[model samples]
Target: MKPENPLTIGIDIDGTVTEPSSIVPLMNESFGKQLRYEDCIDYNLATVYGISDEVFADWLDKHGERLYDVAPVHGAADRVLRQWYKRHKLVYISAREARHLEVTIKWFSRYQIPYHHMDLIGSHDKLAAARKWQVDLFLEDRLENALQLAEALSIPVFLFDTPYNQGTLPRLVQRVTSWEQVDALVDQLALEKANA
Candidate 1:
């Protein structure tokens, strides 16, 4: 069955649409620390890298734009999002600073990622933005953000699986390993909504 109303999907850009490990190489080269994506068992990179928060913040301040400029899309993300672009409104709600918007937009253009709207909230708290957008579903890579959005918005959230986000999840938050799985789940959701 076709969707009666286009679902507004709130998506996270960095680690959700982009490869979760896409920043690893840049960080490794910048700080001269040998770090692999698998070694990132904690979402807090400062904790994972054993660096002070100030140090990490400084690094991000200096390199965040370039990081966004070069980060690669996650596997199958381009294909899946392009398909959904036809049926739903994809709103990218990211924690990146508003200053990074230009690079972010350029990144999307460079990669041909599809989005109907984009919001760089500049912080991890996205409840307000999600509410404003009236999202029916959300996609995220951060465990905290996923849990918060799922509980607060009462919306189903697809949490992209990452080494860092292995914590227990609430029923509303589903862990997905790839964009292919996400695509299938979205199809199931549309069917369920149609049935209802």
Candidate 2:
């Protein structure tokens, strides 16, 4: 059931809002990690760099503040977040960790993303938190999280496309190729909800 309060939007980070693919190459080059575009989901740069999870987690402990410099995602993300910020309750549910919280806020302010309730999830299991938020609509880029949330919460999830997520998405989650399509989809969803 929809919350009686204003609809809360759960927005994903990385591929959804920030240029996650862009960062992969940067991570490969800068961190000396050899991660491919496809390997980023489960293990990510840590595996590519031959760094163990413990080491990578330690690195985050040391350099967590640097994530703010992550590049923007082609202006579509900021545009959507800004529009929703004025009308609905918005929470940025990022796989990005709590250690990076300060830098995340600074980054959003620096980039003018127009979101306030930023959540740094400990686990990659987004569906667990999505249920807790009681989101009306969830926006994400991964086929896994989108489809899982769709089945679990019956919430409409918009799955932003990437080379990896292609052909693997389920029917319950709508696929969008670009941020423009995401905006249009959100608008349509808002209108439908209003009418209903």
Candidate 3:
């Protein structure tokens, strides 16, 4: 549901707003594994690929920048987000490290993704940021994070569906597959709040 004030929406970046499989090609090339997005049932690539954490870290250190730089935006996200930005507070709370803030902002600018606030929290624990911002709703891709945020904040979370997150979700956590669905859901939430 919406609030009396403009809704503050907390959004995840990587697999949510960006092309869901944006990093798969890079990961495949880097690790010599031909894996598809549906094959990734876990968030940790190292585990999914059966590589050591140190090797994963080393690979990231070498290619992370390029990956982020070229990652594509999900279709219609720019238009929908820009529309929402006019009436709501769009807060991007990413698990990307604090050091990547500049590049992240640059990526947004490059892609023309509208946002009011950006927080590089460096981890998947986004509850604090959501609480701090008083986010009325959250859009996410990580199942664990969505579950935790919805349960902890007592708010609805629109989980962007991915193979990695295909599972039963709580009533408060709705699985969405497209930006159009997200926009419609937000409108429905606002209508429900207005009626309430």
Number of clashing pairs per prediction, in order: 0, 0, 0
TM values, all candidates: 0.96, 0.80, 0.94
- Candidate 1, residues 1-196, lDDT tens digits: the string is 4447668899999998888998889888887899999999999898988889999999999999988988888999998999998888899999999999899988888888889999999899999999999999999999999999999989999999999999889999999999999999998887777788
By TM-score, the candidates rank as: 1, 3, 2
Instruction: Give the best candidate by lDDT.
Output: 1
lDDT, model 1, position 176? 94
Q: What's the candidate order when arranged by decreasing lDDT?
A: 1, 3, 2
Q: Kindly list the per-residue Cα lDDT of model 2 for residues 1-196, writing each as its tens digit.
A: 3333456788887777887566565556557666677675543456556778887777666654554466666556777677767777887787887877777777788777887577789667887777777788888877778878888888788887665566565566888777788777767777778778
lDDT of candidates 1 onward, in order:
0.91, 0.72, 0.89
Query: Cα deviation in Å at residue 145, candidate 1?
Result: 0.7
How displaced is residue 62 in candidate 3, in Å?
3.1
Q: Residue-wise lDDT of candidate 3 within 1-196, one digit each (tens)?
A: 5435567899999888888899889999988889998898887889999999899888887887788788999878989998898778899998888888888889999988889899989888999999998999999999999999999999999998887887898999999989999999998887777677
TM-score of 3: 0.94
Sequence-dependent TM-score of model 2? 0.80
Best candidate, TM-score: 1
**Regarding lDDT, does 1 or 3 come out ahead?**
1
lDDT of 1 at 74: 92
